[model samples]
Target: MTNSRGGKRERLASAAARVLHEQGVEKTTLADIARAADVPVGNVYYYFKTKDQLVEAAIDAQDSDLRTMIEALEAMPDPRERLKTMVGGWVDQRDLAARYGCPTGTLAAELDKRADGLDERIGAVIRTFLDWMERQFKEMGRDDARELAVALLAAYQGISVLTNALRDPELMVMEGRRLTAWLDTL
Candidate 1:
């Protein structure tokens, strides 16, 4: 692909994500994404065969970023500290969640509307991260690694949801610590 083509594709994905974040998946359209990305409508089709494809690409990009972050958790020596750091990191990016509405959750919700295999693809990315975190917990001798992983992910998701709804960063941190402490037992 040409440089222009690659650039256009990036713009399209960015715009698609913006559209999904702003208007939600149900209301977002190719034209809206094109406008949001500041690319010509034709450029969108050039990169994406369909709107679902565009959404999938955008979601994949976001999930890849999340996986990268989760991978870093392995570097932290303490599992308890690692868990807290992970949630703290989420709190640190409160601005991103406040602005973009939690890309993981948003994409997951959007994927539910499409039957083009997006859910499994996105789910795989999520599971990859969750599995990594669970491994950390299991290595620390936490027998309920699976359940702890589920709870950890759920807590972060809940924090994102509540942070977005309440616009309180402290609430997220406070509740995250509370939940993190609770999860350490499991």
Candidate 2:
């Protein structure tokens, strides 16, 4: 019973993440999340007392996924390759980015406009990626590693915005190629 209850909670959080990504925080509701998770609407309250709590759970899930992805890249000995692989991974999600923008960036933007305290929580996703990229650059022995990491993150975020605005998934792929080429030159 405990395992089943935990699974339901996990399912709810995952559904909340997807719904929030598609609808933003303002439009997403507990009922929407419950429906997405195939859980009874009343049961949502059992897992999360409020929308903010569910949002926090979603953010935690995203952070965990990001850490896992970065850990995979860390196995590579060459920092440049690790960075390139990361760009490729983003490119692979071009279709999704075009449809919903970046999950973390879009959520952060919405929460930021609301003046809610959740901005810091959502921003942690970007910060984690930035920190990982900075470490990669530092591993490559670049003195300007922090700047490079910021530039790389900025470029990706800009690409995500453009992809969503223009409804052009190809743009992400093209930008990914350009970023890879630029990284090669560094």
Candidate 3:
């Protein structure tokens, strides 16, 4: 594809991701994404043939972001600090989480309920985070690393749900502090 075409596709994918996080898959329309991307609605078809394809592209974008975040966390010498940094990153996005919940969690929950074939795709998005967390815990020499990873991710998702439902960004910040303190203990 040409540079312009690639740029338009990337823009559409980004807009779709934002819309998906805000309105969810059930409510987000192609036109909504197109408008947000400032691309012609008809031109969206040139990039993605179907809404599912567009949604998949959004998921892929999010997955790429998760990979990037993990890569950054890898720079921390200590695994515990890396985990804490992950929590801090979430805290940094507290406002957005309060408004939309977690982009990956919300998408996974919504897609899971749909019973679509996209479950594996959505699972990969979450697995990337969980796997990284597990690796960190394992590096810390914890036998229950897998369990710890699950607990941490669950805590994040649970807090995110409350934050969004209660419209309180501080809830996430408080949770992040608590998680950090908990990490220090382990």
Candidate 4:
């Protein structure tokens, strides 16, 4: 419902996304999201019937953010430059990734263990990105666009895990530069 502060559902979903990313799905509670959103815990039920539903909303929130980012990148004139900037943007998150691992990756890994279909929803987010990357590669006339997209995203995710394990943001930066350089040659 709309309030003086804005839509409570949106706020709760946003807060749930942040809390879920920071705390992981198992560790996050609806009350925690309500607290973060500054909404009464009871009010959360009006928006989400259960924590799983809230998690689903948070997943949608994450998807929305990713789609928005893709839209921004779509504005770039060059597909190659768009790809480079995407890597750069990810590299910029190295510090946070080091602290909590990649947000999308963390959520996907954590949620995959669930019996419900939440994991598939999160997987769709990754596929969304992969599809976007593949489109960009295809735009650049790469016949192996899908494979290249997978390789690039896989590399980024691998470095994200290592960056967190090693607590070294530089690892992500170095890999980003390396990936961008490799992109320049294509």
Clashes of each: 0, 0, 0, 0
Candidate 4 residue lDDT tens string, 21-134:
899888888889999999999989988899999999899999999999999999999999999999999899999989888888989999988858999999999999999999
TM-scores for every predicted model: 0.81, 0.97, 0.97, 0.96
Residue by residue across 1-186, what tens digits does model 1's lDDT show?
598887888778877776787777778889899988898888777789987888787777777667677668767777777777877777787776766657778677667677678887777877877887788778788888888788788878877887778777777768767876775665
* Model 3 C-alpha lDDT per residue in residues 1-186, reported as the tens digit of each score: 599998999999989999999998988899999999999999999999999999999999998889898888898899999999889999999999999999999999989987777778989889888998999999999999999999999999999999999999999989999999999999
**lDDT of each prediction vs. the true structure?**
0.77, 0.93, 0.93, 0.93
Q: Candidate 4: what lDDT?
A: 0.93
Candidate 4 least-lDDT 10 residues: 1-10
1 or 4, greater by TM-score:
4
Pairs that clash in candidate 2? none
- lDDT of candidate 2 at residue 112, scale 0 to 100: 89
